[model samples]
Every structure is written in C-alpha cells, then in structure tokens.
Target: MTALIEAESVKRYYSNASWLQRLLFLGGSEIQAVDGVTLRIEKGEIVGLVGESGCGKTTLGWLLAGLEQPTEGAVRFKGRSLGNIDAETRKKVQLLFQYPRESLNPRHNVRTILSYPIRKMGHTATADITARIHSLLEAVGLSARYADRYSFQLSGGELQRVALARTLALEPEFIVCDEPTSAVDMNVKVQILKLLSDISREKGISLLFISHDLSAVRFIADRICVMYLGKIVEQAPAQQLFDHPCHPYTMALLDAIADIDPNAIRKASLHGQPPSPMAPPAGCRFHPRCAYTEQVGTICWERGPALQPLSTDHLVRCFLYPEVSQDPDRKQ
Candidate 1:
C-alpha cells in the first residue's frame, strides 16, 4: 500500500557560488541540506524527526510540505508527485512554522488571519468563514473573544494556538510541524502537543513533527527518525528506538537526557562536533564522532554503510551490525 506521504531519495542542495566563480576556482560551497533521504508517513501517523540544529530537519519538512522543491528527487502524496497535484490536493498539505509570531501577520486580527485561507481556498460566504474561524479558535483552545486581537497583542502561547487555528482552518490532511513548541513555555508546549495529537486522531491527519526534544517526540510520535548532518542515521518505532537505540548518535542523544537517578553517571558517550555538510567526511558522516568507529577500523572511514535493518521495523546506518542478515522487505 502507498503511504500518505513519501520522499523518495530526495536531495536539496544550495550552492553559495555562481557558475563563473566555480569555473574560476573561486570561493564556492554546496550545502547538502537534504541528501538522499527516503521517508514515508502513513495516514494519521505522527513521525517525529529528531536531530541537532543544522541537520536539515526543517529543509526536509519544507520539501515534504511542497513549500520547497527538491533538487534531485520527488515528494509524493498518495503515489502522486506533489508538483502534479491539483490546487485542492495541494491544500491538503500544510506547514506550521516554528515561530508563530513571525509567520502570522501583525496587521491582521485572529479572525482575519484564519479567514484568509478559508476565503481563498473555497469558503466564499462571510457567514461560513466566520463560523469556521470561531470553530478553529475553539479547537485550539482559544476563546471567540480572541477573534479581534492581533498577533502582537497575543502572548507566545496564544500566538502559537492562533497559528495552529489558522492552519486547521484549511482542513489539511497532512501538516509539517517544524519545531512547533520550541518558542513556547513548557506548559504551553504540552498544550500544543496534546492539541496536535488530538487533532490528528480526530481528523485522521498525518504529521511530520520536527524537533530536537526527544522527550516530546517520545510522547507524541508513533515512530522516530534520527538525522545527523544531512542523513538519517536511525529510524524505528518510538518505543523501540528509545529502548534499544542502535546508532551511536541515537545512544548519545538518549544518554544526554536527564535520568531519573540523580546519582547515576550519565555523560553522553558521543563526542566532538558534527562535520560540516558542505564538506562531509569521505565515508560515514558520523565516523569522527562515533565511539565504535575505532573497533570498525578503516571500514568506518573508507566506506559509507547503508541503512541496514536490525529488526523488521528498526533500521540503522552504521557498521556495528555487520553480522545482521539483510532483509529484502525492509531494505533502505
């Protein structure tokens, strides 16, 4: 069966130098933001994409949402190319920006903000638009009284809820939530997560939740994908990944989190900064930071390991599991 959304070996690159500069051997670099990534999101499932900053999480989200085109591959919605989708189908995919204040227009009030998408999309009657605006606000836990308030007048949490209401107004089938809770307080973050999860369940909407917060991802995601630099290092069910993380990067991230035992030693085993995307290492991008690289010898430095299946659903891109048999059904 086809997934609701699929990114097939997509790559998005940005060149800092012009054609003339590159020809002259001048200063130029290519940023491999999203390199050779293949991901699938089933309908109504929340897939959390967790990684450090500059790991291309946002870029991949944009590509998946059809807000940005991939340089090499294609993002498909239900087996159809995003570019070939009609306007109505396009509306089914939406992006929720990380910063709500910046994404919302200060000049417009909450009602106007929510009404614009509705009006432009298909709602022609003022009465229907007004009803939808209020309903969306209510759905996000906002009162109808907030309808007249502008973005500047709202608090950070309120602004985020308003932003979510604006998105919900479109009745999208899928949403790319890019760090939705990063700008809000802890309590508000919980509210946003609950609201998102509830909406996805009630409306059968698929979501790609991008964040560095492992705890949050564990709470809301059915599956988790760990990215490093520009490539996915590991992917598995949320519980499986947290319980038995296969990749060194995933282990380091889990170890770095605060443990319940205050006396327990919990220093992250992984060390060193990530290599630059523009000049990634010759072999595995994470070889320099992986503790097990020495045990693997030059194999870690001379050849990039493919994303191999450790179990039926768990996949890790590393050389530590050379003995594991390749499963054709779960091949990366």
Candidate 2:
C-alpha cells in the first residue's frame, strides 16, 4: 500500500514569551510544542492519533494538513514532497479544525461558506454554486433549508456538518480531522463519526484522525498511533493495539478509560503530567510516568529508543524489547 501522507522526523518549536518578558525581568523558558515525530498513513486508510492535552496531536494534524510547516524534517503527500508541491496540489490535502463555531464565519450563511471553497478552486460555475451547496448539505446529513442559515442559527452538530460540507467542496483526497466530534453531543458525535466513515469508504479518501478519545478511535480507525510527549510510542492495528498494547504508555491510556469491562484487571494509571517537550526526558520520553519503567534502565535515560518492529505490523519504541535494539550489548 502506498502512503498518502508521511512525516519524517518532524519538529515544531515555539519560543517562550519570557524572552519578551526578559526585557523587563529575567524569567520563563521556551516551549517545544512538537518535537521529533514521524508517522505515515496509507491511501484509503484511517489512522487515529491519540494522546492527552498538549501532547502535540493537533500540531501534527496541522502539519499533515499543510496548514503549518515543520521547523524540521519533511511531510510528503501522494509520493510528492509537500515542500515541492504547488498550491493546487496542496489543496488536495485538507484540514478540518475542532471548533466549528470558531472555524466558520459568523456573518456568512451556510451557502456562502460552502461555496467559498468551490469558487476559490475555480472548479465550478457561479450559476451552479447553489445547486452544489444543496447537494453538499444533503451529503453531510444537513437539510437544504439550512443553506441560507447563519452560523449561529444552527446547532453545534449542524455547524460541524456545514464545515464538513465545506471541506468536501475541495474534493480532497486526504483529510486531517482534528478532534472533529469533540465539541458535539454524544448522539451528534456518533452521527459525525459514521458520516466520516461512510465518506471515506465511498470516496476512498485517506484520513489522519486526531483525538484524545480512545474509544472513538477504536470504532473508526484501522490503525492506532499512541503519542506521548512529542513522540509516537506505539503503532499497531486497531484491534491488536487495544487487545495487546505493548507500550507502557499505551496500556496506561487504556487503563485510564472509565468504561473498561469490570471483569478485566486494570493497569495502573499514569501518574504526573508529561514532562515539558522543550527538554523532554532522555531515553524513553514516557519512562517517567510509565508503571513498566522497572524494565527500563540508565540507557532509557541517556539515549532515546528507535521505533522497532514487534510483530509483523506492530511497531514500538521501548527498551523492553531489547532484541530490536541496534546496540549489540543491549540486544536481548
């Protein structure tokens, strides 16, 4: 399978505001929002990215969507490097933000919002924009009557559908969905997730679905990537990941979910907030909070682990599997 999107050692950093404040008083430090991270998504497949708040999931999504550029490394789409692509090619990869209310223009009606992208693309005639809007409205489970409605006139779910319609207007081959259903009601969230799945199946569009909701990811993703700090600690088939999570961080996350079966024994919860990305912990970024840290050693503190294959499809970055390590002395 060909990768529709790939990120190689991507990194994004933000200098602390204290630098400015330092002019008045000495204090504060910089922040590394997204550190070295790499991932890939095959065509027509959905890959879910999950982590706690401020874990750089949204930043990774934006990078994949081309809304933001990486400070280091490269992002490639459809066999072509993103940096080499023209604007026309870039439009084929779209991003859907989390907050529909903030993403949509309050003053613009639904029709205008949907038609804006169509017109900008120069792909349709002005006379046909209204018809296209109606078709899109229906495609996303919205009523044609809402075409003339303003952003505030509709409910949260309705606004999200409108946003989806606008994204569809571009006819993108790949989409980075950043927490698409997080702000909506549970019923609406289910509808939105089903709608996304249906659209992906029907259109063969590849998706990088970013969310902190593990349960939702289980339902929609073919594969899962568990991120910690600024790095991916585990990647595996969705079912395999949930059933036999290899990374300690991944297991901690599943344990933290409240709805797990009562008969199943729970793993210990991850304690303490993740360390600052600016100076991420040495070896394993997750070692500090991991209950399985007993298996890690000084090497996990002095050197970072590379992603290594566990099973045919599962890949994890941890010293627990020393057989995959490059160091002969460390090889199990």
Candidate 3:
C-alpha cells in the first residue's frame, strides 16, 4: 500500500513563557518537544508510536494532524505536501484528542455536536444533515435518540463514541489518535479499539495510534516506533520489537514490563531521567542511563548513531548492531 502520511526529519520546539511574563523574561529556554523524527504510515495500516511521557509523541501527532506545523521538516499526505494543501484538502486528516469529555462542548447537545462539522463542511439541507448525523451516530455505536442529550448526560465511553462520530462526520481518510483509550476503563477501551480497527479495515482509513501502553499498541499496530527524547530509537514490526528489541533503551523498557523472577538477582534499572531536550546529550541521548554504556566509548559520546537497517524493514539507532558496531561488549 502507498504511504498515506509521511514525515521527514520533522522538528517542533516551544519557547516556554506565559504571555503575561514574556516581557519580563528576555530569554527563556526552548523545549525541543519533537526533534528530527521521520516516520511513514501506509494506507489502511495502523502504526503505533510508543514512548514515555514528555518524549514528544503528542507533539508529533499534532504535527501530522496539521494542528501545529513543524519547525523544520515536512508532513506529506497522499504524496501531496501538507504545507501546500488547501483548507478543504487538509480537513481529510483529523485528530482525536485523548480526553473525549473535555474535548466536547458542554453546552451543546450530541446532535448539535455531531452536526456541527457537517454544517461547517457546508451541507445546508436539514433533512440531509439529520441523515448524516444518524449514520455517524450508528456507525460509532451511539443511538440517534441520544443525540438530543447534552454531554453531561453521557458516560465517558458514550462521550468518546460521540467524539468518534464527530470525527467521522468529516469522512476523513486519516486520523491521528493521541492516546484515545487512556482515559477510559479497560472494557470501554477494548470497545473503542475494536471500533477503530473495524472502521479502519472497512473504510481503508490510516491511523497513527500514539500511546504509552505497549501492550495495547502490540494489539493495534502492525508496526511500532520506540521513541526517546524526541528521536526514534527503533522501528520494527510489532512482534519483532517485542521479541527482540535492539536499542538499549528499548531493551530496558521491555525488561521493566516483564515480571521479576524471585530467585534471580535484581538487575540495575535504567539510571537517571532523560536529559533535558534544551541541552540533550552530545552523543547517544540514552548512553547516560544505559547499562551497556561501557562499550559505547568516546565515539558514542562524540557522535549520534543514524538509523541503520537491521533487516528488511526493522531499523535501529544504536552502536550494538553490526552497521554501528563500535560497542566493545557487543563485539566480544
């Protein structure tokens, strides 16, 4: 399948200071929310982006959704540049925020909420608009009867379904789902995920599923990208990443999830929090916390490793592998 969305060396930075205080502070440090990241999503495929909090996952999603433009690179959709697309064309891509309740307008009834997008898209007839609203509600597992009820009357899951219905009203070809299941209960989460999967398969909609939940990503995504400090450390097929993670950071994360063996000695966990993106480490950003840093040496500290091909599709950015095999421990 052709790539429906592609980001090349995308970067986004924020200079932090409230508008009221900006005049007092002459120079505030810039936060590198997303730095030099590249990714591609094929039509009808689900690509999961997994990382810890403050790792730039949400920023990347925003860039792809066109909610925020990249500071550096470009986001392309269906072979056309996002920067060049007209407003109508851009509407083909939608973003579903993490919290459905907070995202919805409290004052509007569900019918008004769902119909708002349709009306904005310029469908004037009341009969046509009502039919579209009903179809969208039914598609997202909500009844048309609930359309007259306000957001406060709905449960968390129901609110989320309404949000989904609203998004579907635009008939978007691609969506950036930023932690869509994070706020709901497990049962509700399962329902949402299943609904998203069914919609994608049936309609051929592409998805960028961003979440901190590795297990959830494994079930939803065909390919996975592991990110650290605004960079993609590893990209592989979902099963390959879970079965054999190459980057030290990726290994540490997987180890953190596994049940600890009672009889075995406890190994040291990854040390130190991620370095500030304002002044990220000179070499490999993860070397400071990596247990395998002994093999990294001066080169790993002096230069960053590029994403090297490990297999047909899997790629990693660490010195332990053959193309970047400067690590003495891996050599031995």
Index of the highest-lDDT prediction: 1
Q: Model 1, which residues run further than 4 Å from truth?
A: 22-27, 260-263, 323-332
lDDT of 1 at 96: 94
Candidate 1, position 18, lDDT: 85
lDDT of 2 at 304: 73
lDDT accuracy of residue 210 in candidate 1: 97
* Winning candidate number (TM-score): 1
Mind giving the per-residue lDDT tens digits that candidate 1 earns over 1-332? 99999999898998899889988989588999988898999999999999999999999999999988999889999899997899888988999999999999989988888888889778889898888888888999988999999988999989989988888877899999999999999998998999999999999999999999998999999999999988899999999999999898899999989778888875446677778899988888898888788888898888777787788889899988874665553333
Residue runs of model 2 more than 4 Å from their true location after superposition: 17-28, 260-265, 325-332
Candidate 3 lDDT, tens digit per residue, 196-312? 989989899899999998878888898999999999999999999999888888887877765767565435456668888888888887877877778756667777778777988
TM-scores for every predicted model: 0.94, 0.91, 0.90
Residue 327's lDDT within candidate 1 is 59
Model 2 TM-score, 2 decimals: 0.91
- Model 2 lDDT tens row, 1-332: 65788998888876665656878775466566677777888878999999999889999899888877898888999778897798888888998889999989999998788888878768478668888888889999988899899999989898889999999998899999999999999999999999998999899999989999998899999999988877788999999999998888888898889854777776677888888877877677877887766756677777777877898899888878865536543221
Better of 1 and 3 by lDDT: 1
Kindly report the root-mean-square deviation of model 2 from the true structure over all alpha carbons.
Answer: 3.4
